[model samples]
Target: MASSMVAVGLALAAAGFAGRYAMQALKQVEPQMKQALKSFPKTAFGGGFYRGGFEPKMTKREASLVLGLSPTANKVKIREAHRKLMILNHPDRGKTHPDRGGSPYIAAKINEAKDLMDGQK
Candidate 1:
């Protein structure tokens, strides 16, 4: 009984020491973690495209990017790009399983990009 009690006491002391060491280690790392986080950009990842809240009007540059076209692309190229994107991403294309395929939001964005691109010319 005394040997078991000694073993238990030693185990408890070792655990307490380990926990204290871990807490000290964390405290030392806390300032470095804060500094690293502070150095990061305020915007979300993907170059800030996934920002929260309401979206602004699509710019010409953004339209071109959506359609995978050059900013200086002509009307014919723009039309072709729009057609290709619609064929691939149109929500209606996912007839078999509505939720599993194309996204309505993406389709809407593609259409909006086409309209914006057309109007800017």
Candidate 2:
């Protein structure tokens, strides 16, 4: 297996398609990643390396529903909901509190939902 991977690597390097192949592999692994990478500008906003953007696909309504908030929910309500949900679902909390098994994806989704809602307001 090691030798096969080394040979593949050498072949890709010789073909001068290593970076492109790697990026293509990344695209396959993460279907949603292509949009973010495709939108990159030549330079970053703060005059640094342009780290790619992370635009979540969840719409405002979807995000609000995920957080159990109404579409018209204000920032305070959103903030409170996010805090409560994070505490209840956080991974660290799982170790300390078994009843609440840590859910990293839920936490991340909650954050994305908040971001989507926040941007609208």
Candidate 3:
């Protein structure tokens, strides 16, 4: 019937108007959102205030802990610890290895700790 067609046409016009209104509202909000973000503290996002030294420097003590060595461990002990840990957590050793889970990140940290220990000698 003509009445049904009119109803469909009205519904379509209402949907189009709603869509246009929503787009305008979003446009109005966009600038305000950007301004709010700019006014916010950089540290809140872990980028602005903490850029340079936010991360603690890897210390000899921390390196020894990573390698499971005593603070007074010598070069030989450091090397031994490094090798043992690498054998267990080297990225090449897939995580499916029995009783061990190797990760690329862990392997990198292990290498870094070994290098730090070596540098002290």
Candidate 4:
């Protein structure tokens, strides 16, 4: 019991010393942090768009826009939008394809857009 009490007292003293040191360190850092924050862009911690193949490649707004549908669109509307967009963007539609010789890239993007939008279904 005596040993335990000594250990507890040592722990409390160590903790108090550590806390005091941390408070002093924070006070030293506070002005520099304030200055850095003042120079930081307003977009910090917000309005971040995911990129570089990370995750969440398509936000709801982006998927909807790609499919030419509203964000609140139903499956039927999404399907219709995807179909209409695909008709114009399909790569092998051949002559009179609007793109004339439609590119595979556009078709892939259209298909991806459809898939993203239809994911909810």
Off-target runs (Cα >4 Å) in candidate 1 are: 1-55
Best by lDDT: 1
Badly placed stretches (over 4 Å) of model 3 are 1-55, 95-101
Per-residue lDDT, model 2, residue 72, is: 86
Q: Which segments of candidate 4 are over 4 A away from where they belong?
A: 1-56, 95-99
Global lDDT of each model? 0.80, 0.75, 0.78, 0.72
Tens digits of per-residue lDDT for model 1 on 6-60?
9999999999999999999999999999999888765322344643432588788
| lDDT measured at residue 101 in model 2 versus the true structure, 0 to 100 | 89
Give one clash count per candidate, in the order shown.
0, 0, 0, 0
| TM-score quality measure for candidate 1 | 0.51
> What are the root-mean-square deviations of the candidates from the true structure over C-alphas?
7.7, 13.8, 11.2, 17.7
User: Model 4, 39: alpha-carbon shift in Å?
Assistant: 39
Candidate 4 has an lDDT of 0.72
Cα lDDT for residue 98, model 3? 48
The alpha-carbon deviation from the true structure for residue 15 of candidate 2, after best TM-score superposition, in angstroms, is 91
- Could you tell me the lDDT of residue 117 within candidate 4? 71
Q: For residues 1-121, what per-residue lDDT tens digits would candidate 2 score against the true structure? A: 9999999999978777867888788878785666777676543223353344334677776776667778788889989988988888777876866776877787788888888777743
TM-scores of the models, in the order given: 0.51, 0.48, 0.47, 0.46
